[model samples]
Target: MSMHMEQTVQPPVDHSVSYPKFLWRALRAATDGGPLFYGSMTILTIVALLGANAWAKQVVHGMAVTDMTDHVSWGLYVANFTFLVGLAAGGVMMVIPAYLYRDDDMHDVVIVGELLAVAAIIMAMLSIVVDMGRPDRLWHLIPGIGRMHWPISMLTWDVIVLNGYLLLNLHVCGYLIYTRWLGRTPNPSWYVPFVFMSIFWAFSIHTVTAFLYCGLGGRPFWNSALLAPRFLASAFVTGPAFIVITLKALRARSAFQIPEGAIERLLSIVRITALINLFMAASEVFVEFYTGGSHTASARYLYFGLHGHEELVPWIWTALGLNAAAAVVLLSKPLYRRPGVLVAALVMTFVGVWIEKGMGLIVPAFIPSTLHEIVPYVPSATEWIVTAGIWAFGMMIYIVALKIGLQAMSGRLVRSDLPPAVGAVPQEAE
Candidate 1:
């Protein structure tokens, strides 16, 4: 006698919740965490508050309170902006393998990179706003209201690309997470085209930022044909390095299971890109030293100091050492396999790139001055506080967003209290 076996079918869940309810659930998930999470949030909040207070003092007293003067109008603020832009662009590295190359493992965790990009971009925008000294001046860059010299001004291009990239990431990440929460497979039509567009847009954001510096005829320090490529190379290094560290942390701290393959792929990218970044730096150094013209003044001031102003000399060397060491560690197959060593190396890489791209790149350009006057720029206490606050605020945003993402990925933050079953039809909720 043949026996017929019947498979039990799961009932179709509504999987549809109002947008406000969805948001409320997400907020709750973001706020609910263990002691370590709460402690981190508290620290970030305190630092952010302190930063806000410093910003208020700066606003009341005006830009005069800061060390920036006629010689160096741009200081710590712009340096941070430059580095964060690259960090944001570096996020695309994760997307490329996931979407373009069809790496299923990468696709599973690609949202982590996207969320990081979103936070980095937000920090970059805040950096620009703070740099403006008078926040009201931003109205001039606003479309329809302000005379944004679009097509003509590189700054205008930057505003467009940055904001556009930010929106693109927001939409893609949100859609994917929401769909996952509904336990439905994402429709490629909704996010695929934009995902591809974001890849090109990522390159554009950094390229435009590089052009912003190089287009200035007076700043010989930034007027290099290799500037854009160097920015991208370093971006690839920082972004992947950060993601590697984050993935490891997630694996250890949470129920989230990041595929070991994802980490390996990211490390491989960092290994190659770090060397490329170093090569570009070396090439630029060769050109600057070999050419040895008046234009080389900035390079000289950066590496060896000009007119006895050696404030930045030590900073640049430290950056170089950190980057070289990180690259060596990453390239060593056996060393990177060790979690502790890998995290340390990634930290070094992140800090190294931050210094290399930030103060090391931005400050020296103004040292010798256009008229050959030596006026060094130093970040005042107010600038430091404000910078720290911005960083803290960005980290808070990243941490909260990550929590929500993890919940959604794990099917814990769905419309129903019970876990979502597979193959549920996602209902459209207003």
Candidate 2:
């Protein structure tokens, strides 16, 4: 009896999944079946489309139509580009505390910071594109066909690093969000290493952005050795302040439970960075005033009257006062404890940093150009429209990202092996 045991063949497991289905589920998650989500997304889409229209006009008219003269090579767009890069890089502060310091509250909301970074970088890239004389020729940055001189050109380095950092964050954030969508806890193996790498990568992005300005020897305002540290410190202050404000908004309405001390943690970070930033500013002022020279002309114009051009003086002083006041508010024992007061402080801090890094910083640098001719650069009406449009578009991106992240956290997204019963809400951890 040849006992040929009947081999029961196990059917091949159908592990193959459809990309279209995944996308459909992801879209459903982002939509959230809520009017608020859809309404906000609709508004954002409209604004983004308007921005596209503005960009089209800019592309057709050429760079000459803008207020940027030859003396001020970089105008509003470049100034915004520089600022957005800092904002994008500043998101890393949240990452460091959450991933490295093991702050669970930060970890809960860390994705929000990453989402902000993604949107800011996207905006930064758009700012660069719009500022370019011929944005259509941007493809030249690609390797092989394009003559991007590696390591030799800082501009080339910037292009490479910005895109690389963007990719790294997208990969990490996308994986986490997607896994959460699938209702499966993400494997640390997938994203943990990338998160670690991104910390340093974030520093590099902001440093390179600083170098872009400071490396230019011709610009006295930007040639300071302290510019790099100043950039980092201000970034540390401004970025956290922005996040704190945003988190406060979310907590006020959104269902996601913000960690108990997340805002407090950010407040602490802001206070430290704010002090450092003020110290750096004082140092720069002292050196500029003490070593009076033609190079100091720009600084003189910034803080004091230069040939009766005292327009920036008032603005700079206002920014300084706001910054100091914000620092004081944050450092206050009673005020910092109140949510409203904290938000006010952060608003002041963010606004002050914006002015300091923006009009206060960039405008003065080019006020009395290298020729000593006081050729002031102001944003034209068209420039303002373009700026507003871009800003609206960026916020749109951020809002959508946050929506998706919130859906993921709320467990309403496409979950694996644990889908909620038809129309039923998922159970909360608490």
Candidate 3:
């Protein structure tokens, strides 16, 4: 008898089973029919659709309908886009824990984080496209067509690197998850390149963003060498904060339980990162003030106040205090060990970082403006609506990706009969 036939046969399976049954079960679990998920989704959908309509109207009627004047060309949408991009890359920082330490608990969540990265990048691209005066002519940036501005510009390089990194993330993430669904192993050779590229890309996105403002030389506040490091510190804290919050929400909503051990471990990791972030901010304060140059003046304008523009100063101080307090709380063994304290720490860290990195970063760059004039640009209603849509879209993308990933991992909806595969592989066949 053939070896295959000679093998002890397993119980006969019914090949006639309905595939829809499997698919429906997976879909239901992912959607969960919860008010929070669906309600948020509905609100976002309406907002996004309205934003899209408004954009179309702007395109047809010209940019006059919106509040973007010459003084503040880049409004709320652009600022939010910048923030979200950094947040998207937040997950990339965790690769150190997973690969370097071989922490298996982080493995399952890593891809989910990567998916968030992908969504954030897409949102950035969308925001940029929308902000363009001549989005139709955007294609001219290509080599064969228009002036491919290079060598003279970091943005040219940024364009190349950001898109390449996005593709690499998608490929690496898609291959790994798809293969898992197919019950197969990834081709390590292919994935290794992506893994290394992803690490570099993570650093590149934030570095490029900092350079975009700093390299101008005119913007003294942004010109500091410490800018890149600060960007990294902020990203490290904010990204992890977002993940912790999301994971907690997931555990609460889903049947899958987050182990007390896992929660504590993640809390400790976030606390350490948060402390590092606070340390960097404090060091920046010392260096900027101690140096006592044009840059220091600008920094003071941001931290203390500059003329009437001091509107953000008190809020900024509040953010700084909150960040430090949260970091201390997390660093404590007893607090970090507790789920409630951990959650609170993460919440504070996330909010504080959002304020610090979002407003603190952007506002500081402009204050004591390169031109030495304080041009306060408040966001318009249109801008707020658009920002809401963008945020919703990001959450929606994350929700969808997480649901799909969980289903594949749990052997629901389009799952393979074989054991779960870990890393990169093909997408289609079982």
Distance (Å) between predicted and true CA of 153, model 1? 0.8
Q: Residue 265 CA error for candidate 1 (Å)?
A: 0.3
RMSD of 3: 6.4
Local accuracy of candidate 2 as per-residue lDDT tens digits, 299-414: 99889969987877877898899999999998887987775787888888887887788777777788688888887677776666777677888987787677777666556566
Superposed model 3: Cα runs more than 4 Å off: 1-36, 57-71, 257-265, 336-339, 415-430
Top of the candidates by lDDT = 1
The TM-scores, one per candidate, come to 0.93, 0.90, 0.83
Sorted by lDDT, highest first, which candidate order results?
1, 2, 3
Across residues 1-430, which tens digit of lDDT does each residue of candidate 3 receive?
0101233334443434634544454465457655766787788788878777766666777766656555445555666666766776677755655555666677556665687788888787777766677778888888678887886787777677778878988887766655444443445665766877788888888888777767877677667788777777777777877777777877777754344444455666676778788888888888889989766766887788767667668768878888988988877778767867777877787778877877677766665556677776556666666666666676677777777665565434344455444332222111
Q: Rate the local accuracy (lDDT) of all candidates.
A: 0.87, 0.79, 0.68
By the lDDT metric, which is better: model 1 or model 2? 1
* Off by more than 4 A, model 1: 1-17, 422-430
Candidate 3 residue 319 C-alpha distance from true site, Å: 2.0
Per-residue error at 72 for model 3, in Å? 4.0
The true-versus-predicted C-alpha distance at residue 20 of model 2, in Å, is 3.4
